[model samples]
Target chain A: MDKLIEAIARSGNPSVVGLDPTPALIPSQLMPTPGKDQNTAGTQPAHVDDGDDADRARSLADAYLRFNRAVMEGVQGIVPAVKPQIAMYEALGQEGVRAYIRSCALAQEMGFSVIGDIKRGDIGSTASAYASHLSGVPGGRGSSPWHEDAITVNPYLGSDGITPFAQAAEASDTDLFVLVRTSNPSSGEIQELKTEDGRAVYECVADLVSEWGRESIGEHGYSRLGAVVGATHPQAGRSLRARMPHTFFLIPGYGAQGGSAQDVAAMFDDHASGALVNSSRGIIGAWRTSEGYSPDMSVEEACDTVSQCARAAAISMRDTLLAALDAR
Target chain B: MDKLIEAIARSGNPSVVGLDPTPALIPSQLMPTPGKDQNTAGTQPAHVDDGDDADRARSLADAYLRFNRAVMEGVQGIVPAVKPQIAMYEALGQEGVRAYIRSCALAQEMGFSVIGDIKRGDIGSTASAYASHLSGVPGGRGSSPWHEDAITVNPYLGSDGITPFAQAAEASDTDLFVLVRTSNPSSGEIQELKTEDGRAVYECVADLVSEWGRESIGEHGYSRLGAVVGATHPQAGRSLRARMPHTFFLIPGYGAQGGSAQDVAAMFDDHASGALVNSSRGIIGAWRTSEGYSPDMSVEEACDTVSQCARAAAISMRDTLLAALDAR
Candidate 1:
């Protein structure tokens, strides 16, 4: 946790680009060609060509890997971390998951912390398995497969569900970001519901995050266990910041999700080191909507422009956040 | 949901064997030999040889695949469904995920409804991505990769997080089991907290689930949207059943987790068709701790006995559940 905080401080940025690669985001040249395999019986959906499924999955996975590698190179110095939402890779099946593993590896090799955005939660043994997977415990060939500095976790199953993850993080010297107040439009349907004690569900979650972090405080005075409080709710962010003094924050909902730099300013401490504001589509696909970029460009041409566009977007976001911090 | 209810009715059993394969549960011969991969630089833990990681993961995954297939065959006629917990596969990385895909495919092929026990939750786009993955939308070569009939989801992010999954279920004519009262020891830490409106947190989530299922009710008077109420808390399960009459239940925490047939009896409707009880470790690893089983058995001997042991366990659980229903 302190390492992440220090990185943010050294880079003069508290932002992380979310590498959520979808088929549409990949360049046209990288799209997989249809496979010729014919073994389409059983659970493979009728819509897909059964025989060539593995080949196609492998192709798409490769495309995503290339795209992610490019994006990592583009955003190298502007951001302190890269969060690969596991679901995106998961959607592509095993091949995509392998791409996710490789993507995390490349990001770390490039000197950026990797946050595996896998919102996994379960009971005892199941939860332990997930924690082990993240921390690389009982790893294959004596090494963990996916090397992530931190991983996002859901707390719906409560403490026992989270205990295994906490223990894994403690043992591995990694970190955890528990979901608290999400940035979605309908998050309040449950998170904002008032409790009998006058606290909202999110507030209760924030308190738990604070308590969970107490034992894992780092040299920077922040716990490795953090809370994911979305940037969309500025007021909630402000209150949660005050409540979870020891807990760092992973603030999503920035950029395309409608959270501006000003909206997330309260998430950080006075030094602007307590939070990492994430922008997925905003950075990765910046070339699509940037003023100087054109959608009609050839695949190779567009690919060449993505790095510059992504870097520009990261710089812009970093400056905005820094300005917000300065003003506060 | 109606399809699931019908399957349960046809089998005269509302139980599902959870295929959560672990290394210990796999026969000794299937274990992967140590790999020679040396790519372990960067964040990859120093303890593992990175060079042969993929091969090792593939070996482990193949072992798990064989084990799951055997279990599916063993429990084919006795259980109405098979729930593959995604975590165990995820631990092995991409190859493990492939095994999970094949496991679900095999179970479905064997005529058992598959419930993907992937407790995934996220906001909007991410949730939609997960849903698409579940439904095999944009699957490799245009076919869905996994063939699950239903999936378990978490509801911590509120309505927005669940909406995408519900939408996907509706579109695909499948089902969803949203977490309400999870089958964990510390579930009450948040689930049982009192809301200001005089409802517990789980009660509030139950109301939301009922509402989500309203538009998707099927012929059996049950909606495709179900609730996961742990068998560990029978009283809570009973009340949740009464509260969400149209919603079915995926009851976990049986056998190894200490929930008896009598304990989960209330989860079912009068016709004994509203729930599917899941027993993972109990059914899949029955031979490991069974009376006649010994660790000293040869690998081939253990493999031969696993199916019989699994079958006996399923038959025993089925009888116990039927007796409980009859008494009710």
Candidate 2:
């Protein structure tokens, strides 16, 4: 808990980039030739022939890998970590899956922790299998190839479903970010169900996550286990922070999802480092062309600008949160 | 329900073969040759060194594909369908994934509907992606290399998570099996939670499954959507049958998991076709010399005996239930 907090405090930003490689959004140059406009997504490029499912899937995987590698490599010293949404790669088929693995490796190589946003949940034996697949490579020592440093898990199946993941994380010194309060509009359907205790289901889950992190406390003051709390729900985030004091927050819904820096900042308590605010589409772009900035600006320049914006929002929120803490 | 009842009445059996391809259970001859038991899962005969993670994963995948194919081919006419557990294949990595696709295709060709036991759950957008990935190809029509006739889903994410899967099933004339009361020992941790309304969470999920199936009623009196009610939970299974009259049941925990034929027969609800009882390890190699099956009995003979035992149990149950119904 303390180590991650200390690291984030030293870095001066609580920014975490979400790598959601929407094929349609990849820049033109990055797209394999002939597949150039194919990457543009909804826009129909002229004289373009749609490839077979396998080929399109292959290209899509390539696009995802390229974009993810670029971001991880580009933001090495800037962001604290990268969360790769498994859905995006999964939509690409086997090739996309291969690309996802490559990207995870690249992120690790670039000195960033990889949070596999898989949201997987199951019962007993199946859950154990996933725990092995995600954290422990079958016969090997140390980290597994199919493993992630941490993964986003679905807690609907309850504590038993979470136990195996927690055990695997502890063994690997990895972590889990169970979905506590998701960013989706429909999350209220189940997550907000009123419990006998008067707490919503998400709150109930938040309390449990706190308990799960108890054994994996890192010297950094953060536990190896965490929670996925929506940055979109500022008030709920504030309340959950009180319930789960030691848990790390993977705050989604920032930037393109409509969550503001101030909203995300509220997730932190006294320390500016407890939350990792994520932005996917809001950043990672050929921003110069889209924003009509100078065409001469390099990819590095665009990333720097994106980083500046994300960092500014986080920093301002941290200051506001600090002021509130002091007043209290 | 009427159509399923009729099918069971005709077939005179309620047994289902679960395709759980654990690498450890693969036959020696079918495994890659030239390797000793000390290396590469002790099953792969070839690629003794197994070399890197990629190589070991590939070898394991080959074994899984071969095993699943043989099992599907072996039990095609005898069993109603093959319930392939997705986790087993997923553990084998991408190559195993390829094998999974091939096995599903083979099963479909053999006139057997495939029940993909993935147990996946997520928020709306991602849920849709999984539905598309499992039942159809991901990335729209013809974009995926593999597709199943039906997939098992988790209901923790609530209505939004389930809707997309139902919609996908509707579009493809495919089916879905949502987890209701899982057979795992610790399912009580969440699924058994009692609400103030006096309904357990699993019961609420069962109600939702029934409601979702209303949109996909088949000509056979059954809906394409189904529920995964573990055979181990006979009482819950009986209760679920009453609640989900039109939905099919994919029942796990037969054989190796210790649910007896009589215990599972209750799931059939007198008609003998309401549920598909899945036995993974028990049926896959019942005649194997290593597993202590009579060495004199051929594999086919073993399969026949097991299938017949299942049939007799189902028929006895059917008659008993029918007599009770007639008395009423």
User: Which residue pairs come into collision in candidate 1?
Assistant: A37-A51, A38-A51, A48-B142, A48-B143, A142-B48, B37-B51, B37-B52, B38-B51
Which residue window of length 10 is worst by lDDT in model 2 chain A? A286-295
| Per-residue C-alpha lDDT of model 1 across residues A1-328, encoded as one tens digit per residue | 9888888888888899999998777766667754433244344454544447667677888988988877877888889899999888877776778889999888988999899999888987889889865566344443567888899998878888888899888877889999999999988988888999999998988888788788999999999889998888999999888888899999999988999888899888877678899999999988777666565676566666787888998999888888988998
Candidate 2 per-residue C-alpha lDDT over A189-268 given as tens digits, one digit per residue, 9 for 90 to 100: 66776666677777777877888788888776678778998877889998888788788898888766678766776787
Q: How good is the docking of model 1, by CAPRI class?
A: medium
Steric overlap count per candidate: 8, 15
Chain A TM-score by candidate, in order: 0.92, 0.82
DockQ of 1: 0.49
lDDT (Cα, tens digit) per residue for candidate 1, span B1-328: 8788888888889898999888888766657754433243345544555556667777788888888877777888889899999899878776777789888888877898989999888998889888865555354434456778889998988888888888888867789999999888989988998998799999999999999889999999999889999999999999998999999999999988889999899888887778889998888888877676665776556666788788998999999999999999
- Could you say which candidate leads in lDDT? 1
DockQ of each candidate relative to the true complex? 0.49, 0.28
Model 2 CA deviation exceeding 4 Å by range:
A1-10, A28-51, A285-289, A292-328, B1-13, B28-51, B134-140, B285-328
In Å, residue A305's CA in model 1 sits off its true spot by: 0.5
